[model samples]
Target: MAGHRNIGSAQSQSFSKAERLNSKKLMDELFNKGSSFVLYPFRVYWMKHEQPVPSKVQVLISVPKKNFPLAVDRNRIKRLMREAYRKNKFLIIDSMNGNEKNLAVAFLFTGKNLSPQNLTPNPSLKQRGMATQKKSSVKNLPQYKLVEEKMIEALNQLSKNSLK
Candidate 1:
């Protein structure tokens, strides 16, 4: 992690336990005192940690039980969300390191469950001439990509307003 990172590459990506936010007290405070924003499928909530650390960030990802009644459905969604974050977090980590702050964030999946139609590539993707015809990994669905894009956008916005 000390050296340069390759953007958009999944080879070295990881979401280790150290980077997971699990404190009930911290989570409670984040909801009570943190700022929040809706990034479509996800509702993001974040707050700066009192003691800043070099790691830069710790995050919690959740899929609501209401939307996904079955445990398997919720687990699948959470897995995809976590994978997307693991691949996309370098953008935020570098920016946050520059600002020297530790941030705790929660991403709650709020969108309705993906129906059969939703699993198919978007019409806009087809219109844009993206290759939707070829078989792709089940993990490469458009919704998950959208989640990554929205997360990056939120991280950029957060970097601009980071604790100074």
Candidate 2:
């Protein structure tokens, strides 16, 4: 190799730091004062406030134990929610426009056990070419799509609210 230099240490990426909200007052304001939009799986609440310095976004993740009785199931859902947010949050960031305002976002898992009545066996159909067409075994997740769409809608609403 003519030139192979290690640049792992030299390279740095700017990542957004999550400012978690743990105060009762903040939580109350978030629920009371903020406007919320439900995208099935996630309900996003946001409000803009003045700050001496630029405020970073705060986030909270929650899973209802009643819905998911097992700790493992709750944890798994939480992990997936976090990953989805992490991957798609950049869209929200881009919408912020460098405002010196704080943001609070929460992802609540609303998934419950599928009803037995809703369960149907996958039936295989023969294709014209060769392989048989197999029905997808994956459960439909409308909430996930709702989350993404509602995020965009919320961002738009937030921007409009900021203008007023």
Which is the leading candidate under lDDT? Answer: 1
Q: Ten-residue segment with the worst summed lDDT in candidate 2?
A: 133-142
Pairs of residues at least 3 apart in sequence or in different chains that clash in candidate 1? none
- For model 2, the stretches where C-alpha displacement exceeds 4 angstroms are 1-17, 51-55, 113-164
lDDT of each: 0.71, 0.53
**Residue lDDT tens for model 2, 1-164:** 56553323333223245355565676677778977666545566766655332335555678787665657556655665655555455455555646656666555656554444533322331233322323222322233444445445555555555445
Tell me which residue pairs clash in candidate 2: none
What is the Å distance of residue 7 in model 2 from its true position?
A: 21
User: How would you encode candidate 1's per-residue C-alpha lDDT over 5-63 as one tens digit per residue?
Assistant: 47743434778887888878888988999988886777889888766433568899998
Best by TM-score: 1
lDDT of 1 at 145: 59
